[model samples]
Target: MKNTFNIHEVSNLLDVSIPKLLLWEKKNKLVPTEKDTNGINIYLKNQLVDFPIAKDVFESKWDEEIKIKPLGSYNSIELFAGAGGMALGFEKAGIHHVLLNEIDKFSCSTLRKNRPEWNVIEDDIKNLDFKKYANKVEIVTGGFPCQSFSAAGKKLGFEDTRGTLFFEFARCIKEVQPKIFVGENVKGLFHHDKGRTLQVIKDTIHELGYTLIEPRVLKAMYYKVPQKRERLFLIGIRNDLAEKNNDFKFPAPYKKVLTLTDAFKKGDLFDNDVPESIGDMYPARKKEILDFVPQGGYWKDLPDDLQREFMQRSYFLGGGKTGLARRLSMTAPSLTLVCSPSMKQTERCHPLETRPLTIRESARIQTFPDEWEFVGPKSQAYKQIGNAVPVNLAWSVARSIIDYLNKINVDNRKNTKTILQSESV
Candidate 1:
């Protein structure tokens, strides 16, 4: 999904200075894929994939790495904890998990197998009562799946979304009323139902007496994630807490971007090169057509007749189905990973190999530590990794949350001292 653009457009699009763009070109960091009639450099989409920020393009940056440690004894509860991506990130950021709830047995097994110490509760969120943790847990977070909520009338509120998983997410917030809550979902939720879905969610959070921070789509690529994955993040502070401290800052961006090499090879992100694991195989016919599709090339790279033969009825289709028989480029960041790597609509063929990416390779793209073992069948494992928040992305956000909470804690201690002095006087 890369596109061609001029230097000036690329500079503006990436927020990099024109001089820097030229410097990159000079160093061969970016080479022109094509030259226009006027001899202006026309950059390919792949050239920009591992360096793009504020957008879908995958990129990386190196800033002062946050030295994460417990600000204090902070406790958190996670819901819909799929493969412990966000939970593990928060754990690294120094927050202790009181309990993590997930409905899927396979995912729960994965969580337990990896971290036997974690208190993982395998159950439906609707069946859980979070009231016991009210005013106890400092934070609550979830990557709650988005489900359509039908409106019987114009007054769409919490009750209107009763059966959806997001309702359970909100219900927990309403029950536990944690000091802070973070929710994540796919970026499409922003425009789902013409934006009405998010509006209803906002309204429900407000109804629970929490001050909502204007939701922002956090690109995983911008936060040390190697793939082009974007997650929409929603954070809320309890009304009282927000009133006391209205300044809650988010994490800062990295100065240098990470590349696919940083992910699979022995680099800053990992200790050693990615270990080979079992992966799905391509059918003989599919392999033959894909053999011609060069690295970074998709179905469009096939010969005209071969394309027609492979596409079948869809051979006459107008738009380019770019994902079919795709081969990834080692130099460029991987595309947004899908649950199934071999699907015709979203093929993620290995950069050099003829088959799809392995489970370890997929996990590497997700920024999960090499040691984290995913339980269950390979298919289920792929689905969980594909559906996770990038671990590094969550860690960056967690550091910000910890910093905010640290300030609040200090202020509370000072206030307590002042009140004590007054009473003594």
Candidate 2:
């Protein structure tokens, strides 16, 4: 592809809001080459191509060749490592997994089965001591569950949070003191307990002497995953490290969105068709009802009589309630995969099939390699995949984090040299 396009042309092509575009540029999320003599921002065709959304611009061609930088040799430790989704992404991003901790036997088995070299610590976080990792690992990451505090008492502090998994996460951070740490959770975390839950998390991180980035809800579609998952990312840099520089940036979104067709077919993300695997079956009546829904269609697509019958009282409800009796679309990203795709509130019927997505299909939508297998019963497999951070999305984020850390190391070396030269003088 030719490598230059002006801002206006790029804007029109990408369909992004002008203000949001400017914000992206200013925040250094996507940088333009230079301005023309007329003072209009002139972006190189390469710049437009490099834009996160540019993946869509060259979808057919680039999708086949999109490459990810391999994880280098830097070491990391993971907490709450469910089936190693984030671990695999970070591994792909080039970080070496020094150790991983998870309490679930099935998840632990999944990790060990996939990465025998990894030191899988299979036990509760509270039983482990993280002090051994102090000054040893470069990063610590976790996806601690969110829990509400008793508001009838004093403002929630570290002690008040003791019984929750998040507290264990905090304790590990306090003990390990890695140069940087990452926390991931559901997007609903932002509004949990009217925002106080998030506030407490921030305060806890600050108390542990880290500089917290303003957390963001990164959409999976923006990162090339064929599922519409949203994750809240919490990044913290040790206060001492942040004092040295402030140019960290998040990963750029992929240019193109992926669809179910891109996921199951031979494509950049996978080499061949998804592997055949065991999957959940719908009841006979449920199957009959879902059969009426068209590809990319939902309950509303059913004949009015059937809709009224299936929806029953919910039919009279005020909102789209679209997720109910929903079938997926091949063209659009799949709805967020839940532990149970057949649940009343979160149906994820296949675009064409009458039943819910198969376990392999769920894995593909989350960007797992075709060879990766889940080590559990089918239902447990669904749960593991549903709870995972999309591997590609995590890879994108990990790449940005690595880039930031490398920059920090370089700046530190430069500063050290300057100090030594000054002293000699």
lDDT of predicted model 1: 0.83
Candidate 1: tens digits of C-alpha lDDT, residues 255-283: 43455776789986899999988889999
Q: What C-alpha lDDT, on a 0 to 100 scale, does residue 138 get in candidate 1?
A: 90
* Model 1 stretches with alpha carbons more than 4 Å out: 1-65
Candidate 2 lDDT tens digits, 1-425: 45665665565446453567789998997677888888777777555555545655555332322353433357898999998889999988788988899999999999989899999999988899989889888899999998886641466567667778888998988888888899999999998988888878887888889999889998887787987788999999999999887677777766556678888888856889877888888999889988999876678889999899899998998688878899887766788899886798899998878888998999999998877888988878899999999999988889878877887777878999999999999
TM-score of each: 0.86, 0.84
Task: Rate residue 318 of model 1 by lDDT.
Answer: 76
Superposition error at 68 for model 2 (Å): 8.4
**Per-candidate count of clashing residue pairs (backbone under 3 Å):** 6, 16
